[model samples]
Target: MILVTGATGHLGRAVLDTLLQHTAAHQLAALVRDPAKATDLQARGVSLRVGSYTDPASLAAAMPGIDTVLLISGGGDDDGLQQHQNVIDAARQAGVRRVAYTSRALQDPGTLANELMVRHFQTEDYLKASGLGYILFRNILYMDTLPLFTGPTVLETGINLPGGEGQVSYALRSEMGEAIANVLLQDFTDSRIYHFTGAAAYSFHDVAAALALASGRPVVYHDVAPEVLAARMRERGVPEVAIGRTIGFMTDIKHGQESLVSSDLAAALGRQPTGLLEGIKQLYQL
Candidate 1:
């Protein structure tokens, strides 16, 4: 049977939706922290396995009879690296044939020194040393997160950020989920890493142009200094931690860390990935 962790999350739900199209629900299991939240999945015949990455015993109990496990990265309050190690160790002990992990896409791992990226690198290292067959999906920034970075009134106020002119090859989260599901359904005798990204890289200026075309308005991109952006966010009462993360992400982009364009996503989907303008129109409904 195939097992998916974080099954109630957006990416997990998307993966499960696609998996159900071509596979039997009885052949799948969902690892969830709360069984109460997975009633829909249970009703659909998928076995619910109550577990957390932080809890090794729960993970071990969830792995019996499962051949493959997709380890969706944990978020918020969890020590992500330790959590990943726990899952990896449990899967290894359970004799799962292979394990898949969702990681970020970075062209220069040495340069992208953010806390999150560091943890991903560390996790990858740990997983590699576990002696289990693995699939690493190094995903790009999600097109779905454009609004969060650009703000709600971007069309009215313009796109203002500290990203400079660096470009990002962003893909839709749902599409990435679909690609991941497609990979999981295939044979896993060979270990692999797939850089899931768009066909082209786009900058904040490109985003502005796309917005302008979609909205039929004169949207613009303002490349402000990082300190300036931080001050503006502080004025809006954004938490200091959030502000730091935003700056770090923008800085990484500015240094071309997220600019790598790859066809892995399209190859997995068997079609060209979505473009920036189309994604913008779809996201903003304009």
Candidate 2:
């Protein structure tokens, strides 16, 4: 069976559903922390394996008969290092042949995203060191979160940040889901890594324009100093760690650090991902 950790999460759920449609639900296992949350998935014929990264015993039990394993990084914390290590260790002990891990695109993200990226790097390192056949899929920033980034302003004019007109290729969650399904089914004779991204990059100015058009509202793009922006967030009671990292990340984008689109994902999946405008149009119901 193919087991998916964090199966209850957004990306995981998306991946799971797509996997179900593409293959047999009976052959899939969803490893989750809460059984109640998985009632629907279970009733739909998925095997629900109760597990958590913090609980090594639970993790081992989940992997006992599983074939391919998708180790999605743990949720919402610096705790990923420990949790992922536990999961990987358990997988090793259980003799799972191969592991597919999801990681972040920007390793040195100066944004609030770094906490998890750091852990993703660590988990990936552990998997490599453990001498197992592994697949590293580095996911880019989710295009779905763009709406969240502009939430308050979205209700009126849409929020704007100092994105320096930098172009970043971001993919929709569905495309990511489809690509992951492709990866899970593909032959992996050699150790491989794929950087999953969208078909093209759009500047934040471009994003502002598209969002405005999509929502039928005027959006503004205000470029400010990274430190100044962070200071304002700090004054708004944003945590210090997140503030520093977010600002640093903005600086990186401002300088075009992650401005390019990638073909690696398409090569891996044998399919092209959706473009930004198309995803935005669909998501916003525009």
For each candidate, give its TM-score against the true structure.
0.97, 0.88
Give per-residue CA lDDT, model 1, range 1-286, as digits (tens): 8999999999999999999988999999999999999999999999999999989999999999999999998874448789999999999999999989999998888877466677777888888999999999999989998999999899899999999999999999989999999999997599999999999999999999999999999999999999998999999999988898889899999989999888899999999999999999889889
lDDT of 2 by residue, 1-286 (tens): 7999989988899889878887899889999889999999999999999988899899888988887889987765667688888888888889988888998766344443234356677788899998778988888778887765454445364444556777678888767877887789876667788888877777777777887777677776667666667766778798987776676556656666556567976775577777776777886677
Off by over 4 Å in 2: 107-116, 155-159, 231-245, 267-271
lDDT of 1 at 69: 91
When summed lDDT is taken over every stretch of 10 residues in candidate 2, the lowest stretch is 107-116
Name the regions of candidate 1 deviating beyond 4 angstroms: 76-78
For model 2, what is the error of residue 277's alpha carbon versus the real structure, in angstroms, after optimal superposition? Answer: 1.8
Relative to the unseen true structure, what is the C-alpha lDDT of residue 147 in candidate 2, on a scale of 0 to 100?
69
Number of the top candidate by TM-score? 1
